[model samples]
Target: MSPVKPTLKTIAEISGLAVPTVSRALNDAPDIGARTKILVRKIADELGYVPNRAGVRLRTGRTNVISLVLSTEHDMMNHTARLISAIAGEMQGTSFHMNITPYFPSDDPMKPIRYIVETRSADAVIMNQILPEDPRVAYLRERNFPFVTHGRTRWADSHPYFDFDNTAFGRIGVEKLVMRGRRNIVMISPPRNQNYAQNMIDGGTGAARAAGCSMRVMQGTTSDNRNEDIQLGVARHLAEFPETDGIVCSATAVAMAAVATLESLQHRLGEDVDVIAKEAVPFLTLFRPQMLTVHEDVARAGQFLAQAAIQAVRHPEKPPLQGLDVPTG
Candidate 1:
């Protein structure tokens, strides 16, 4: 015979609590005392009790799901994986679960958001790759949807977000190069349409001007381009502007490509051309001990985004939570 499946009634019987009390405790009801909740949850865990999502949604009008809409163009080797892991870990054992919605760069960014909203598939959404005036942000705000962004837009003050201070990162990267007596610099930035790209460009440009150095933002290619494409672009740019001695890269992959291009051209790293790059993980230094790096703490960003998204769903009336992480060293 098959083993018995655990249910709320089963947990109530095992814990010696009424069915309604057990349900309330499991749901983390405000009225339920802490000790009782702990006890009920412990027994439920031991019994392998899983809530019926259909029944719960039917009763509470909440799907208890959070959708994470990610772009396929992100750095798959480390950044994307770490972010997904962190968000999943944050949602574990909570009343809500996470669903990943992958979209291509060529597709409309609004497609997934519309599907989730129209189908009532999730109670909240978490997304990245924000623009200065993101249409998705505007749409969600107009519909009063609960969402949190990994990057911020112009209307960040009116919504929830957890963004790394790319502006500061850009400035710091340039300053580090300038301190080392490297004058002419080039930044391998992201797409011009991205809000963070502009922020970084502005900061880097301002810093270079203040220091009496020349800085240029590379054209025709972005950090999100393929490794070979980035390598070619870097090679071509270096060929045209051989005076570029200090390089700033927006992502790890971009840095790797730039370094490779420099190596191919027999340029000595740290001595001939130094590179400063942003990374979510600590492996960039391991890859090239001579290269300079700044950590973005993408895992921490993921945790913050998860919590902010849930908060927006549960307490829409409260002030939105906003977090900005500046670069350290």
Candidate 2:
């Protein structure tokens, strides 16, 4: 004989709760109390009751799945496991599941994006580090693929995105340095193709003008995404301004090279220079204890991208371009 399959009624009866109450708890409805929710879920788990997500989606016209895409090879290089884990953990009780797809230039990035739209890889989509002339965005929007961005775009109002105030971050970073009595500041930014880099430069420039200091904004190599480009940029800054006292780097990868460059120039970490850095990964084991830390939590950004994409898919009319600032400590 086949095993008995559990349903909402069966779980509700076993848990000694009303079917409606059981449904709310199982579906993660906000009205349910903590203990009731816990008990009902425990009972459902014990009875092996799996909610029919497909059935729910069918009725609601939603797939409850999201697609997250990384635009650059550097993101692939620093594919943090913590980001995946964090996103999975964030979806513990949500009705949706997430799908992550990676597309590279060499792999014909456009091909995968096309497949995503046609094959229904997900109901909604999320992208990071978008190019100024991004065809993927235009293609998806033209076809009405509901999506969100981890970073903002120039055409942001017509689309939905959740991004940080990176411009403000740059201003704050540089301003902090200026207030501390450093005049010449070098900001290590990503290539111009990336919106974050341009925004950071604008912010730094504004802050520099306000502080009456000289700010030199330099670019990282777009090709290969190597540390050498960052190294060379830092080397230029070091040689150009031996009296440079403060630095702000967009990527932590640059900081690793910056540390090397600083040592080569015989500059002390705290006394000779001060730095404010952003990173997708957390700095857990820095030998230097005094570095001011700003954790970007790219992994956390991945999860947000996942959620926003699903929302856009569900309600195309209310596609949100939140531009959220994932707070850093």
Candidate 3:
């Protein structure tokens, strides 16, 4: 291996090709011939040609790096990986890259923002798993960096974003349960501070008003509850199942917890009580309660947000974007 890290310029020089052409070939663009790509790869390997993030950003006006910020842990859900992959796949021909940056959800989450600013590691950022009053969103907006959010932030009315219409999802779930002869319904929602959670509550209330059903929205705690934390809420409500009748879970965690709790309660899956929840991706199995899901198709959402950020970064004069809502069943 070469002592120095390789760069696009180094590969270009060694392979006797232009920098852009080398970039295109190394990135696996179909436009480049097999011979040139192979030659570039061989030379890149020989020279340890690692692309310098700073140089690339300076040259192309982009770091070729897209950052996906999460409010919770890095491995919060399966959607994280799926979303990143979707954006990366969509950026196949473009000089863009995508990765996730995990930050603790806090009253002041300036750490992630500071990292992005101080290091300048990202060309554009796609903030995900956000709360209603997200400081990161405010920071990015003030800084004038191109960014898109997977979830809507309450601070901004118009911005590039891709989100599910939670109100519709909540309404549909409640309506469906009421149609199935359910009278009392309970909803497990995100904390009240989340905009989507509020929307879900509104939708559920509307359905309840029309159907004459009782709906209560339970807020989540912020004390580091991974998927396991879902169980505590389920355990609290599981004993009151017959009185509850139907359930509307605001997240996959609630759905998962309900499933486990119901199983423990010896309640028949689809027969005793109907369960519906919001999901960012399709489950590997369509079994039981998971089968009845309000799918957000987060991968598609990621693709949409990625395109929006790329466009906004490239063309600032473009009209401000409204949140694109994915229709759910």
Candidate 4:
């Protein structure tokens, strides 16, 4: 013998409500009173009720799922992990749940988006690593699909997004180095194809020009490269540009690689050369207290993206939400 599976009728019977009212409460219907909804949901949880996806879709034509398409190439050191946790936390106790879909850098970014839209697998999508004129954005827009991006594309004005202000980060980082009397500055940016890369380059170059300092973007490798490759690349760049006294890194891993390379060359950190980097968490100081850093708050971005995604699915007729977090010293 086995225990009976909990259903809507089971919850309704326990809560002293009709089946329809219980269903509406569980679905977070706006007409349902908050107190009644809480009571119904409490009973449902006590019964360990799980909604059948097929039945729910048949009735509402919605899967009540938000798909998060993330890149496997992202920094695994607390960056992507924090984002995923925050998004999941935000979706807790909500009508919707999150479904993560990961893709490698070598794979086409559109594959997951296309599959989700074509199959009606998810009600909305959330993604990052945006290009200036991303095809995924265009495709989703054309189909009138409800989606939100963690980073903005060229057509950002028309979509919902929550992005860190990388341009401001670049400028601020350069200004910090310049204030320390460093004239020859170089930045290790992301790939040129990324939209934020251009923003960072523009800000750094513009700030250097204003300060009358020589600034250049490192060649041959991006912040996404492996640690060993980045260390070797930094060493080569230092050999070519010996005057490089200040280094700005786009990622924490890049900063670590740069520091390792400098250390091998008998350069004292914060004395021989200053290194500034951006991080999602505040552990960089624990690793190297001498390093300079700016916080990017990936956790906040995740929460905002999740909220915007839910809003888009529930109320597409309303205005899209947009947020930009500027760098803080």
Candidate 5:
């Protein structure tokens, strides 16, 4: 059998020091001598010893964990994976660990948030798919829990968050289509219930109006729709709006669906129709030259979310850190 891994106790024995002394030295406690600490750290490194997370948690009254609550709907896209990678990367040097918890968006979103707070499962939380009047925001605020959101909420203006400028995305999407000489433009948007969806619509339609171009929003199709449903919706929209020269999508997945549907209808993209979308995945550009994409920096947003969570925990009374990043095609 493989031998057990080295621990603080093993270091204590090998170094001929008390377990408490070894612990303090490894932690670099001020009470320990600097020379002793240097010796212990070297030995610990040589032995490949690492601190026990449970022990550290018990000692510090902190779980040192960051909880990321996501909706099953949102997890369907590639952006979720990118965001998780970014958040984990940001926390790599810190004591905090990232834990993702997925739940059905149809269920009351507050259930999972409440569970985390009640169990103290994590030191801080990060979440996305924000609502206009978000209950999660209210609950976190009431508990004074440290949290960062990926999108804004209308419930409060003073919460730490990192959001893509959906309004700008809308405007850019419309402008791009106009520049391509496409007069009839339609946007495949997320559910109107989401605050960012409305923002995206306002930006796109507002810009279209200013440019004197014909623009319309096709309802009932959302970013969170099932793949088949998205395809069906796109097919139906195309059939109804046979004059649609351009399409704008809220997400990469939606753009993919639109492309597939257009291909099935024997519509050559970039000629018969032009498609533009906001995507977090890089591969979309590699395969889809026919589609123009606005890439959202989900990785940077993840870093900001982690940083905000840390700051919220360490300095709750400080002003909230709010940020927005523009997208690029």
Candidate 6:
């Protein structure tokens, strides 16, 4: 038969101590002696004792849960999975738990934010797909909500965030392609509405101008629904711009399409046509070593977001405001 789960009473009985003393020892109350605390902890570890979160929540009035809000579109690109894994890794060994909630980006992205707040679903939140003037930031700040973002928003500067330096990614992407001795280059970028999209466009074009290389950008698909569209889009662009011999991709979906189109056009990667991309997940490099990629360290972004949310909740007055630029490999 399976053994019964151990509790404070079980520890007290085994240690020959009072129930209250055992409880104090487990909680590391200042009044308890260090020797007693160590003894209690050793027994608890051996017994595999698990704390009752319901009791803890009632005593502290804190859920000890962090909610991550992300877009469904990113799930296809493997970003959501990487971020969640990193956040969970950061939260390991802590009393806190991480929860992921996916939603579609809308004109009013604040709808999901309001839902989580109203339901008291989490103690803190982490959100992404930031806009220039994000209403979610304004609403969260107005309510004094404890939150962090994966990217920056112009509505506020106080909240913590971790973001990839897309401008630099764009600039460096062009540099990498240009180094391959290609003068006519084309970039497949995100929709113009996103702030990162424009940052990338400006960076790529500016760098190309300085290098005396010609560049053009084509708006690419962002959602999984249009997977084939990206491949066809690249094929069309290549057909139209026959002189194009280098490419930069902002999304993995587009990069995959670009590779297939290049093969169809009888162009060799890293030889006839050079390709580079900013990748959220690192597995792309493992599969296609010839296709050079710069990783954004989505896992580290998750770890930072997790820590930022907790700090924002516990120390609102002196919260840590962190802005991270993902390093290229």
Question: Model 5, range 39-112, lDDT digits (tens) per residue?
Answer: 88788889888677787878976777889999888745578889999999998645467999888867889998
lDDT value for model 6: 0.79
CA lDDT of every candidate: 0.91, 0.71, 0.73, 0.92, 0.86, 0.79
TM-score of every model versus the real structure: 0.96, 0.78, 0.80, 0.97, 0.87, 0.84
Q: Candidate 2: misplaced stretches above 4 Å?
A: 1-41, 47-62, 75-83, 219-224, 240-243, 280-285, 295-306, 319-321, 326-329
Error of 2 at 48 (Å): 4.6
Candidate 5 local Cα displacement, residue 193, angstroms: 1.2
Q: Candidate 6's residue-wise lDDT over 137-180, tens digit each?
A: 88888898898887777644677888888888888999888887
Better of 2 and 6 by lDDT: 6
For candidate 4, give the lDDT: 0.92
Please say which candidate is ahead in lDDT: 4 or 6: 4
- Cα RMSDs of all predictions? 1.3, 4.1, 4.4, 1.2, 3.7, 3.7
List the candidate numbers ranked by TM-score, top first: 4, 1, 5, 6, 3, 2
On TM-score, the stronger of 2 and 6 is 6
Candidate 1 per-residue lDDT, tens place, 1-329, comes to 99988998898888899999998887767788989988998998888888999999998999989999999999988888999999999977567789999999899999999999999999999998899899999999999999999888989999999999999998999999999899999999989999999999998999999999999999888998999999999999999999999999999999999999999999999999999999988887898899999899999998988889888988899999999988866
lDDT of 4 by residue, 242-290 (tens): 9899999999899999999999999899998999999988878898999
Clashing pairs in 2: 161-321, 162-323, 163-323, 163-324
Off-target runs (Cα >4 Å) in candidate 6 are: 1-5, 8-51, 75-77, 105-108, 220-225, 280-282, 326-329
Report model 6's TM-score to 2 decimal places.
0.84
Q: Looking at model 3, report the run of 10 residues with the lowest lDDT sum.
A: 218-227
Q: For candidate 5, what is the TM-score?
A: 0.87
Task: Name the lDDT value of residue 288 in candidate 5.
Answer: 76
